[model samples]
Target: MSNPDITTPVRRPRRLRTSQVMRDFVAETHLDPAQFVLPAFIAEGIDAPREISAMPGVYQHTETSLLKAAEEAVAAGVGSIDLFGVPTPEHKDASGSQAWAADGILNKGVAALRREFGDDLIVMADTCLDEFTDHGHCGVLTTDNWGHTVVDNDATLPLYATMAVSQARAGAHVVSPSGMMDGQIRVIRDALDAEGFEDVAILAYSAKYAGAFYGPFREAVGSTLQGDRKTYQQDPRNARESIMEVQLDIEEGADMVMVKPAMPYLDVLRQVADMSTVPVAAYQVSGEYAMITAAAQNGWISREPAILDSLTGIRRAGADIILTYWATEAAQLLA
Candidate 1:
């Protein structure tokens, strides 16, 4: 039935996509449980785990519940858990002193996890003062020369150094400085070394942006933030600025760097990955989780597939590690 003058087309790409097994065999991007990191919140005095209303299925856990969550994540093959401590209002002060106390909730959580997991899981502490500060700013506030109250970056460095040492003493394998303060990495790194925690690593939030995606995170941590953090955190519109930040962190002894609010900034993530010599991490922030959950609950999308796809996309965009609220479920799904 074919004309002699017309040769049949030979390149049919659909032949490779004929079946699921075939697709799997040729898949370029993949996800693994070992690449997932769970971000957990442990409140000081709560007797039971309280589910965050804005972020359904995520909780502000008690110490008991936090251990249980870690056990589940470990069993599912999740690689790491980053702990955020929520202090009682009475414990909060201008300097966020509780942040560096040995008995502090965060340090306690770190010690407990170290005793239980004992290197089975990587324990990371959020080495910032936001959750422990009355003002809910990431650092100490001061009146600048212009009479504007702003986060004092220079003054915050020493506090971060002390906090990192405290977390290291409590057996945290890594201390993540999420305050986005300049010179923090060098200070924390030097302090950890001086305190005999040279083995401990620093995960710098190098490219954290000032975005509205952190709303649910504020509720989860019981944040008392007065205004905004735009003065320190990078503007969402700028892409090249992230490179400068990442480079500075690396130069300051950052073991790894993170790009937060993963999906909206995949372009930045990709660019960072291409140039950086160290491993790259991305955070699937609370708002990203909330929106997907809400839409799926309304039957707008298939929840499981959407979660997997979103995670896969991040991996394809060049993230070596992904900090996500869905870590346990996603790990189980992959398993």
Candidate 2:
């Protein structure tokens, strides 16, 4: 009987992972609070923070609570915050007038954060109609020749341009257009430049997908969605299309490009990161947060570690920035 000697080898991969210090030293990916972007909600009539049921520990905030959260995020070293508005049903119109109004909750929230933090924080606004529109669509709707209601892409572009200008005026350093409308970035960029807000950057949601993963977000925003966004948002089945979308956004002057629903679209994230000339971002959407939180609350997993690991995995997948509900907590944990 013969046996080969296996104790000695030409290489020892485990040597670097043998200890915590060793692992830290040899780590290829490192996460920083500055690489995280938190998305916050501002409700029109709310006087206090309202917790979202599906997303544990997340809230639809009032002006006061939104400012406090912004301050806390800064203290925790989180890089930026993205704001979404929840207007009352009475205020919503077919045009989503509140979205571009200077006094809109999201606009007011951005202004307050800018006033408080000045240049210390990066303030961002979601320049989309879904949160403000009665129909819960991302754009203006019109009847097509077939007598079917559809998003009027060209007509919506002007509204997006106006919303971007308003957000810039409200002190948002970045205006994220997540409507997935064609040529949205170009119209927005043109509008910003014309309004002398050339410094305000456009963060385009280039590869956002239509999926079940967005269910929790509807609740968080108080959405009255009647149907699916599948016609506008990218189909989950396409990968090559993501590259085309990212490229078009870049050419249209997007300062940053993003892939939405980070967990499921990680491959898309990687492709966008590789293809894009601008910084790449991945959104850990509401459903992703809800799933993890639900599992943790059920005692199936350790909450804090899972959060950190999820963010770390996204970072390792080539996302330059991660937009997550757990941004502040993760930043604090990383500290």
Candidate 3:
């Protein structure tokens, strides 16, 4: 009647998108450096940062460079750093004894980081044998009745326990057992408690899968694996099994749980997040990094936007923490 309220009410949702400030204000998920944990590879002999061919912009840092990288991460506001070691071929052995050695490369890295950063940044050591083993299996390998070289679950547990204790003693704030071996969490937890390291936490790689996504990672670690990790790691086709893995790890004393290859397995991440009481982490593995970097390098996409979008998607999928190569860059961008 009053000209039918001629000016139709603005049903537009464009108000929130009108400006950068408005968009930032209404953004559903925001990424911060505190939510990132950078995974770094420290090789035994390199004097400088060596780039992995498959993974552009990522480097295998020497101890000195490793410290510098840690400093960079801290300065950029990253909350934590996870360290992995690449022992020279001469140091690798059948037992992967170096993984538990008191002065192992990884342990040394942990000690160095602790001394340098102290409580300012969280230092997590990768408690696995794959990078240190000559065979490149995640655990100790034994022969089955059929003469197949199978990962010996029972035999591997003690090694993991010892590795956890060594890492803890070296001042790792957290020990992440990425090996999919059975009873590893329980063994590591008991070992840590026995050694009077009751405060050291275990971050279990609970739902790791036997995916081709780890190809670049194997290269990064200098792995000499002859075959796939299908026997130990979970099948990519099974989501329900991931829940069981998460439940088992939680029951066995995991302080936190993670699902690897974050982007492709986000459904598994969501399920684990919904089911777990502890914090859930998502690892954006090497292949995932390679894919985006390659695409961006080829001018197929904008790198910065793609990186942020990928990380935001992981956050939206319920990752309380994200392990990514882009941590330092993302942190600077967020800052």
Candidate 4:
């Protein structure tokens, strides 16, 4: 009795963690592969996947390789695959006309994926101009009387609408508008409906910010952006304004909304999750992935736990879906 009295007096919490089975049973949060969506980049006419040096383990897939990757994602139980296109430099232009071209690489990828998987996997297209634009700003650019570069909001809306309908026609289950242009959702929704694509959904990047976290993404997409996106994307300083952006997009007919660079803006995520009537998604953007991979490569931290922890943290902060470069790897880990 005297020997046991010491342990009883301390009321040790270690009892709950004494066994793996017990720990599993008491776990409050669980990661599922089905909640993850892999973001894949496809370039035109490449024979092999082109690895991005900065982002370890990620690549720009050829159409053939993209289909294979999609199959792998489906096999791994990933819920969806988000597609982006890296056009041949010759195809890029001031207006990013390739974005809405039915025969563009992204559209071709969509059609091929639809043929391969049909409705088995949720196929999403990134309906933005950055990847296709020569200048790499999200929208069409113009100049003021003083020749200052400006993003013409009204002028860019219809192009987004066209891109949305084109993506829908190519068999994308969702059109994700990451351009951050005003009234883009309304324009896209109207365009989709008018084109008889009533079933296609809009996944709006409602709370995207002009943050440094997008550096790796710019490189991933081969972006040529010369300046910042502060004029269009949300300011990082204001959380309350993000709610307005989300609300406006929802009112404009967004089916789902996303918060970019998930970890840093989790407070924003929580606020968006609480206020939104629809599902919430979070993007563990390129920089976030690069940082973790870099640390793991340097042996600064254990990779598996860090990956799981990062995703779990996103989920815990109220993301129903997570768009991550680590989606496939994390899904495999879960499996």
On residues 45-112, what C-alpha lDDT tens digit does candidate 3 reach at each position? 88889999999989998889999999999999999999999999999998899998877788888999
lDDT of 3: 0.93
Candidate 2, residue 158: the lDDT equals: 97
lDDT of 4 by residue, 116-206 (tens): 9999999999999988889988888888899999999999999999999999999999999999999999999999999999999999999
The number of the candidate with the highest lDDT is: 1
Candidate 1 similarity to native, TM-score? 0.98
- TM-score, each model? 0.98, 0.97, 0.97, 0.96
| Stretches of candidate 4 exceeding 4 Å from the true structure | 1-13
lDDT (CA) for every model shown? 0.95, 0.92, 0.93, 0.92
lDDT of 2 by residue, 1-335 (tens): 76667776869899889999999999999998998999999898877899998887889998889989988999999999999999999988888889999988788889998999999999999999998889999998999999989999999999999999999998999999999999999999999999999999999999999988988889999998878888899999999999999999999999999999899988888887777888999999999899889899899999999998899889999999999998899988988
> What lDDT is reached at residue 237 by model 2?
97
lDDT of 2 at 151: 93
Clashes of 2: 0
Ranking by TM-score: 1, 2, 3, 4
- Candidate 1 has an lDDT of 0.95
Error of 4 at 84 (Å): 0.4
